[model samples]
Target: MPGALTGIRVIDLTQMLAGPYCTMMLADHGAEVIKIEPVEGDPTRRFGPFPEDDTERHFGGYFQGTNRNKLSLTVDLKKPEGRDILIRLARDADVLVENFRAGVMDRLGVGYETLASENPRLVYAAIRGFGDPRTGESPYVDRPAFDVVAQAMGGAMGITGPDAATPMKVGPGIGDIFPATLAAFGILAAHRYAMVTGQGQFLDVAMYDGIVSLCERAVYQYSYTGRPPVPEGNQHPILCPFGMFPALDGRVTIACPRDSFWTELVTVMGRPELASDPRFRTNADRLQNSAQTVEIVESWTRQLTKAQIGQALGVRVPYGEVNTAADIFADPHLKAREMLVEVEHPGSARPVTIASTPIRMTATPGGVVQRAPLAGEHNDRILAGCGFSASNIAQLRESGVIS
Candidate 1:
């Protein structure tokens, strides 16, 4: 089936979370993504949550989660012949995405300037810890960074966690996701430009910059008051009874921004008199006594399940039941929206259940069509499409250029 990006070809030279994630989004929309790995393969291959325990063959859950609906290839870029072949592949590729240290591709003779010379319509993209070469390579560009480094330096760590005493990291790898999303946007922009002007351009996204963009609104109070924001745990600083409360089962986060919702909430708990009380009548007044207000709310909520609170508050006041992995896995809304899909791993008999795509199209909707590839599984298949013969591919394999 033809996808939205069906005619596009992306040469993905990224591993781990950020780069592969960007390419996956392109593939999800119908790009022909050919992931190029070193002879030993992407380091992610060695990462675990392996499908099967074996003396030899293994694949990890992280690898499977990000990489799907993409073909794979292996080429040792350190080798001159391998570099030659990569340049050839670049000619027909619509985009080239790399997350290596700034000079890695330039050193291998496959940098954007060289690649784009042959393919003027190519969108060359790079993801980096700080920024990339085309952005005037930073002095720290040589230092490679993963999600944790970006999160720590990019203002995310400063705002997370409770009380500002022990700052905590975000639960997911947003450091990678943010950069990938920005890169995807850049790619689309470049694609539009190429369609009009027949000129390709470099698109670069720094993980640290991406993280800062995501946390842009963190200083809502500080920007006006010159007072830095501090963590107030699950509580919103100015909103009364608008945070996490203990339920019979666990925590249920509730929010009642307006006095009307607070009145309804108080009524739900049979506390009409408390809603009428001058000390808790308005949001400002209630914020002054939030601790007492939450205790009052929890006094009733403690006897109920999160589901009970969610049911009582649904559409009446904004509330969400704090859910664990099990709760999310069993969520009816997620099932209805196709937010979970099952795919059989190449090395496993049983299927793996993973989060599904968030993209939805009225036409040309895509689903999980195949399992994530085994390491270098499509080396021949991808290279053969670029016009390599069987004997040449065999010789290249023999030269230890590919695994």
Candidate 2:
């Protein structure tokens, strides 16, 4: 079956995590993502978690995980011939995505303005730390940034950790991933506009802006309360009995924000009288005495295993145990949802498993059906499709324009 985006062609000129993740999601949904790489390949190809026996080091887990369901084409943009090839590809591309620093693409003469002139319907998108000055100017536009920088500057780290004194970065790269996810949506929106009007526009997503959006609750809380929200360990800022608690084996989380669910929990804990206690009767009262409420819950939970806690409260309220990777792999729910999927790894006898796309459709489900390609694996085929003769391709290769 054809994918929803089967007819779309994307020129993926991105590296590392942020840009590649966005393009990968598009590719997974059946876009023809042509990943244009530098001569040495993406820097992430050297990043590891490699299989012990695969000594050639063709690629690592980081590269494979993000670059799947795409075709690879190597070109050194410093060369005129290489720049020409990309311009030719852009002439017919539906979208072009890149995550270089502010002025890099313009320096290469393949920026949005240049491409949009050639292909009026191209959705040219750029992902940057502070965004391009063409769309909106910022004093920190030229400053280099990474996931940690975005997290810290955007207020996520401010309310993330055990307390205000200890600001912790999130384990996953939500800093980069969130911006990329937003960029994907922007690209699709721009594509729709281009399809309808035959006009293209420059779209930019700032990493700092993306992180700030994810920390939206803090914005509202500060607005409503005349004070900044502080970190409160595992608990919700206002909702009581809505955080992690200790079990005999491991930690579990329970959330009963409403009085009805709280009453149900008290009944389940064999302490029905406590639900009617004035100190914990209403949510506001419980919030004011949150520590006492947590203590009361822990006094009962500490004696039971995670399994026992689940047996008591699993289906009643929002409840779950703190699960590790192994626990997730062993979970029947994850298996039933098909969250983890196996794909063939290069130079490995056994297939490797990676997380699948969360998006599902009734008519055209999208997912990772192909493995990541080798560097420049589709060079000849792609160039030929772009009208390059065999001799022209060989000459470009000889002159170091492409790998």
Candidate 3:
């Protein structure tokens, strides 16, 4: 049988993080993804951390992380001819993914409504900052948003720091990655549905909405207890001893989400008394005295190395060392899982490892097959395959229709 999406074709007109990541997921699963870029190219091609390359456009680690296993094509979408090509591709493509601002795609006449009219079986998926206009326009739809904007506005920042007085934004691109993942899930679901019914639909995924979901625990706390949630800094607000604690050499995390695990942890720490003390007995009591409980736990943990802490706790209490990228690079578990992938960059002249696809499928496994394409690197070849003559491609390049 073919790989999961071998017959599917994706027209990717996305740049930067969110939409690129969504389409990249599709590509990893054997989708024929044609990543369309502006004639100048996707801005990320210039965004660092660029390799030591002489070429003008190449992989930034960020771009390489998200975009791979996809063909590259360049077009000037500002012109009618370029838009026409996109329309033609969309008519035959299984999906179209975009992440333009609220009205940009519609203004360009390539929005869902326009394409769906021509190809009723096309899955038009979009990622937006917030206020996905196609569904319900957010009040902030007109405002521009980046990763941090979505994290902060969507409540991720409100309860991620030490206290209400010092709300902190999440460290990663929570906004882009979460919504991109959600959008990919929606696209896959839509693809399944379209295969069954032969009728495609629009998918609207908002980064802010996704980040909001990520902070839903805070929502539950505030709505139920009427208390503003405070950041515990890598710890859960409700679960004591459920976060990072200092170790002799480095830090590690310990989680006691279950009563039995708590009992086991305190027992191992030679603090079995904590298991019966009225102020620290049950989970509820522990929550009430969370600071003291964590302090006590950390006091024990501080004497041991992170590895020792993890070994003592075992998966029985879900403990792990706080590893850096260097630590990750040296990790045996990650190596066993094949989670680190090596791809060669032109300038580096050596392979650099990036994270691998997280999902595992026995039937048709997915992986990073290549580094990101340079700006319009495959433009001529792809356009020629689209049935343009060699001279026509050259003419388009000469006319600035493509670089």
Candidate 4:
């Protein structure tokens, strides 16, 4: 069956994590994503974790993970001929995504105005550190930024660590990925609008804005209390017995924010009477004595292994083990859900496994259907489809317009 985005074509002009990640989501859902690379290729092609015996080194895991299911067409936009080629491609594209700084695309002569002129119904999406001036002006518009910068400036790292004084960046690149995910949603919304109105508009997502939205709880907490919220370590600030607790082998998470669930948990712990103890009777009482409540819960949990704890409380209340990659690889739930998939590595004899898309549809499912392409792998096919004849391609190649 055809996927939901089977007929859409995307021109991917992103190099790093954010833009490529957004385009990856589209490609996984069956969009014909054409990744436009410069002569040197995306810098991520050099990022490592290559197979032990593989030596050709065409690409690495970082590039493979996000660039899957897309075609590569190298074009050096510095050349007028190269820029014209992109203009031609964009004329027929449904969406064009890029993550360059504010004025980079305009300097290349293929900015939103240039492309929109060629394709009125194109959804042009830009993911940047701050945002584009076209929508709104920012003081830091010209400043370059990465994930950490966005996290720090956007308030995510402000209340993210063990304490108020020690802020920590998140393990994953949420600063980039969150904005990329929003950009993808925005692109779809704009595309839908174009389909209805026969017009398209430029949309931009700031990494800073994305993280701010993600940390929305802090916003309201500060507003409600007239005081900034501080980090409460692993536990929630307002809930008691709602965080990671020690186990015999590993840690487990248990949340009991309601009287009924607290009663059930205490019963399972062989301490049912404590549920009604004056200090632990209600959620408010427990919050007032959170430390004591946590100690009481840990005293029982520390005696059991993660599996033992699960056996006792898995379906009764909210619970989970702190899963690592090894645990995830061996998890029955992961297999049952088909969350991991194997794909061919270009330079290796053995195939490799990567996480599959979690988007599931009954009639038109989406997934990783193709491996990452080699640099300029689809140059001939793509240019031919763009009406470039054999001689035209050869002449362009001779002029160093493409690789």
- What TM-score would each prediction reach against the true structure? 0.93, 0.98, 0.95, 0.98
By lDDT, is 3 or 4 better? 4
Query: What is the overall TM-score of model 2 with all chains considered together?
Result: 0.98
Q: Give the TM-score of candidate 1.
A: 0.93
Give the least accurate 10-residue stretch of model 1, judged by summed lDDT: 50-59
lDDT of 2 at 189: 98
Better of 2 and 3 by lDDT: 2
Residue pairs whose backbone atoms clash in candidate 4: none
Q: What is the model-wide C-alpha lDDT for candidate 4?
A: 0.93
Q: Rank candidates by lDDT, best first.
A: 4, 2, 1, 3
Clashes of each: 0, 0, 1, 0
Tens digits of per-residue lDDT, candidate 1, 1-403, equal 7778889899999999999999998888888889898888778877777655333444677888888888888889999989978888989988999998887888778888899888999999999997886776677777889999998877788777878786778989999998998998899899889989999999899998899888776656668778876667888877887888899988888888899999988887777888889999999999998888888988888999887888877787788878889999988999999888998766666788877678888787766666677778898887798899999899999999888
Q: Candidate 2: which stretches are off by over 4 Å?
A: none
Q: Which candidate is the best by lDDT?
A: 4
Model 4 regions more than 4 Å off: none
Note the Cα lDDT for every prediction shown: 0.85, 0.91, 0.83, 0.93
Q: State model 1's lDDT.
A: 0.85
Give the alpha carbon lDDT tens digit for every residue of 1-403 in model 4: 6889999999999988999999999998989999999876888999988999779988989999999999999999999999999999999999999999999999999999999999999999999999999999999999988999999988888888998899889899999999999999999999999999989999999999999999999899899999888777889888888999999999999998788899999999999999889999999999999899999999999999999999999688789999999999999998998889999998799998888888899888898898899999999999999999999999998888888
